[model samples]
Target chain A: MQFLLAFVIGGIICAIGQLFIDLTRSSVTPAHVLVGYVTAGAILSALGLYQPLVNIAGAGATIPLSGFGHSLAQGAIKAVQTRGLLGAFAGGAEATAAGIVAAVVFGYAAAVLFNPRS
Target chain B: MTQSQGQGNLQQQKMQQELQQEYKQLVKNVKPRPPVLKNTILAFLVGGAICLIGQLILWFLKKEGLGDKEAAAATAAIMIFLGALLTGLGIYDVIGKYGGAGSMVPITGFANSIVAPAMEFKREGFVFGVGARLFTVAGPVLVYGFLVSTVVGLIYYLIR
Candidate 1:
């Protein structure tokens, strides 16, 4: 049952992305869609709308790019509570530091191992 | 004169019909019919699998007594790590080719985006090549993502 929920939710997100491809005749790249999702997620998270979905769907909700936006909002909120206005500037990066750092580190490792054009 | 006009109309209609058929043939030749069913099913399964792994990681972290927020953050980081590692090993592209959107929608996909570009640009020189191009795909995402989040934070701070 839980698996079904996750599958359905995650699949819907991907299907929406596929829809963009079809509708735009492939002109709009996937990166743009992902960026749009992230921005929407950030807005929804700030409005306190996305947490309920996350609560219900678990990774189904959070595994998408939107979830990254939600985390950024959450981090900023926490930071604002503790550090005041400066958190606005610093909070998102701090919150996502682990993921960001991991990407660079692991990305560097991969670059070393693989030929680019292959 | 009336008979000549009718003939001209008939000729015009025939030419229009032929043109329509020619247009259809051109479209058919230029655009390949996508394997819609296969792509959809692969996307569904692979996307679900990635989330399932994420849920398991979340479960284990929570079981270890981390707070919900902490566990969720850790899970995301770990998944990103896995995605980047797979991308580096040249495996994620294969999965991506087969899985289509299934592999690209997850947070791991974001990691793959970052790693793929870095690898592509590495030969140009590390600083200008790898570092500069590292964010080709991810830069737009992070830029708009962070900018929107900051604006939202400002609004929330002011309103609350």
Candidate 2:
């Protein structure tokens, strides 16, 4: 069931991205991606909805930018309460480390498998 | 004869205007952006495959009695290392070329962005070596990501 959820959620997110590609002529995607994630996280957090989504989707919810935001926000909040301001700043990165690290490694493999042409 | 010549001149001007309008429409409607349908399908499949592989890797590690965090971190390390290795091997460049944002939209592209520049600059110097340059492109992304997340978190924290 969880796996199904992951599959569905993950697929949906990608599909949405495709829609953006199809609809928008905007070449400026990175900014949009980053902003979209943070906004999603903020809204979900406000509703107290993201935590449940995380429970359901795992990386499907997380591997995207919004997931990164949730992790960071959750971490920062936790750290600030326990360790103070310094903790707030550093905690977010640690929380999102898994996804960030995963991205790099997978990306490197792809790079190795196929050489890019200029 | 004068009336006939005027009609011919007017007809030519109208056709020219029509041609210009069509050119403008083509530029407006169809762009050079990567094909959305294809990229979405590819990203979903490839990204899902990567995650599935990760879960399997993590399960095996956990079965060995490693804690969840340890197992998860080990898997993440493997993924990050693989991504970095490919960036070095120049294989990822090909994926980026073919996949466009399809490959990049996933974590892999971010990894490549962070690592590729560093590898290129490895020969520059040690202090300002490949390691330093590693974050060049990716740093801004991380910064943006980090700040956004922090602010969101704060908002969440303050409210709830």
Candidate 3:
């Protein structure tokens, strides 16, 4: 159920990009700005505004930037008292390393295998 | 050194300038980019799939020797390194080409942002140019991510 939630949540987020592509005249270059969009969404989620979206979407809303933000936020809270100010910088990376590594290895492999046409 | 010869040389110089101007004008006259639905969807799926794989890795690591906390951090570092590497090798761009933002929305994209600019400016000298601009785009994300996360932690504590 969790995996299913993650897949659907993640897939719907991806689908938004599809909608953007079909509806607008934006090029691939502008579309690359997705990192920014996700970050914004995640930050908003952290602030509590995006919670409803996450609840409704399940993993979909939370998985992308919001999930990421939640991870970092938790990390920071964990590390701040022990590490002080420096914890702010290191916490997120420390917390989310597993997910990060997985994405890179598999993403790179996919790049190699599918050789997705640019 | 005759008037006729001088006139011919002048004519050639004038023609050269006109051609340069024409080329510049042509470049400026490009049409606005049209939307590309297919590629964008491809990017999202590809990018999201990357994240999904990251999740699996973390799960595997937790199942192994490491705890979930340690495993997750290890995953981030490895992925970030790979993303930085691919961005340098010009491979990440190719994925971005096909998957669109879908390919970029993951942590790897953030990794690319930090590494790509640094690589580009490596020739411009390191400290001021390359090193400084290296993490420029990523700097904001990191800073903001941290700040937001702190707030989130507070909220989580309060609620749970």
TM-score of chain A of each: 0.88, 0.70, 0.58
Q: Model 2 over residues A18-84: C-alpha lDDT tens digits?
A: 5665577667464455455555664565356887876676555654445556666777777777776
Docking class of 3: incorrect
Q: Ignoring the other chain, what TM-score does chain B have in each prediction?
A: 0.79, 0.69, 0.68
User: What is each candidate's DockQ, to 2 decimals?
Assistant: 0.53, 0.30, 0.21
- Compare candidates 2 and 3 on lDDT and give the better one: 2
- For candidate 2, the docking band is acceptable
Q: Per-residue alpha-carbon lDDT of model 1 for A5-83, expressed as tens digits?
A: 7667877766666555544565677688679778878888988999898888788889988888988887787777787
Models sorted by TM-score, best on top:
1, 2, 3
Tens-place lDDT per residue, model 3, B117-154, is 56665556657655575446655655566566666555
The best candidate by DockQ is 1
**Per-candidate iRMSD:** 2.0, 4.4, 6.7
User: Between candidates 1 and 2, which one is better according to lDDT?
Assistant: 1
The root-mean-square deviation over C-alpha atoms between each candidate and the true structure, in angstroms, is 6.0, 7.2, 10.0
- The estimated TM-scores of all candidates read 0.83, 0.69, 0.60
Candidate 2: Cα lDDT at A110:
44
Residue B124 lDDT (model 1): 89
Off by over 4 Å in 2: A1-5, A29-47, A84-86, A96-118, B1-23, B29-34, B97-102, B123-132
**2 or 3, greater by DockQ:** 2
